[model samples]
Target chain A: QKEVEQDPGPLSVPEGAIVSLNCTYSNSAFQYFMWYRQYSRKGPELLMYTYSSGNKEDGRFTAQVDKSSKYISLFIRDSQPSDSATYLCAMSGVGTNAGKSTFGDGTTLTVKP
Target chain B: DVKVTQSSRYLVKRTGEKVFLECVQDMDHENMFWYRQDPGLGLRLIYFSYDVKMKEKGDIPEGYSVSREKKERFSLILESASTNQTSMYLCASSYGGYEQFFGPGTRLTVL
Candidate 1:
């Protein structure tokens, strides 16, 4: 099985809808979880990051990790057209050097007017 | 603000041509990485460097090589560009944490 798994979603939501993005992993060594937002042809911007589970919130976005189940989530509240983009989840072990990051095949989001 | 800058926002090159994609980070990050974003492939790492003159191969390092002569600069070289190698190239820097700052990306097209 691939180390990380995420549904490639072209999820469409109306304005003000709350969007949820998720990823599951099989690697027990993973300790760092991150969500990155990519606009069209631009590179990804780090949105939220968390270590050792629980949840972290920043503005309209919230990131959650469940180490027990190896599941991670990103929640976007009050979605807007500006939120239309691809969201990628990446993870790695805590002490490993920055090497190959297991990345989810991003979920595409399109917020409608 | 910490910035990761890629040399080109877009480029078009013929197949078999040599290409150089440059990346420079303002922050003195210990780790630098190169990844390519494709529609279904997501972001696949091309190469990475932990320190100056130190490098490692990522998942997809077949046709790509990297250089880190200076602490602030990381360069990805496509010795002979191929049409199949065309994609959005991204440069990222991190300080051994979950948070990574990324360059704007270079979109390359091989004709």
Candidate 2:
């Protein structure tokens, strides 16, 4: 099995709808969780970052991590067309492997007006 | 704001040609990484350097090598480009390894 698993959904939603993107991992050592947004033909930019199992909120986005189930999620409130992008979840462990991150297959999202 | 700049936005080369993808960062980050992004495979790490003159192989390092001669620059080299090597290459840098800033990416096609 892949270390990280995410549904590569070309999920379409209307503007102002709430969107949730999630990822699951089998590794238990992951302590740092991150969400990245990638536009077409562009590199991914960091959207949200959280340490350990908790929730972090930034503007209209919220990132949640559940270590017990090895699951992480990014929720978008009042989604806009500008929010249309591919969302990737990345995680890394502490110590020796801290510098390297394992990424999940991204979920593509399109918020239409 | 941290800026990561790649040498190319698009490149096409015939098979067996040597390819070089350059990445430069202005943040003076200690960690730099090279990753390839494909349709299904999100981003696979090719190589990474924690410091100048030091490099480490990532999950997919075969047929590729990396050079980090300066603190702000890292290069990924394909000894003999293969069709399988055609993909979107991305470069990233981080100060403490938690949050990363990425470049625009280089789309390379090996025929």
DockQ of each: 0.62, 0.74
Best candidate according to DockQ: 2
Give TM-score, chain B, model 2: 0.98
Q: Candidate 1: which stretches are off by over 4 Å?
A: A98-100
Score candidate 2 by lDDT: 0.93
Native contact fraction (fnat) of model 1: 0.64
lDDT of 1 by residue, A17-102 (tens): 99999999999988889888988877788788898889999999999999999999999999999999999999988666644467
Candidate 2 to truth, TM = 0.97
Error (Å) of candidate 1 at residue A99 is 6.6
Residue-level lDDT of model 1, residues B24-71, one tens digit each, is 999899899999988888888889999999999988899999999999
* lDDT (C-alpha, whole model) for all candidates: 0.91, 0.93
Per-candidate chain B TM: 0.99, 0.98
RMSD to native for every prediction? 1.3, 1.0
Worst 10 residues of 1 chain A by lDDT: A93-102
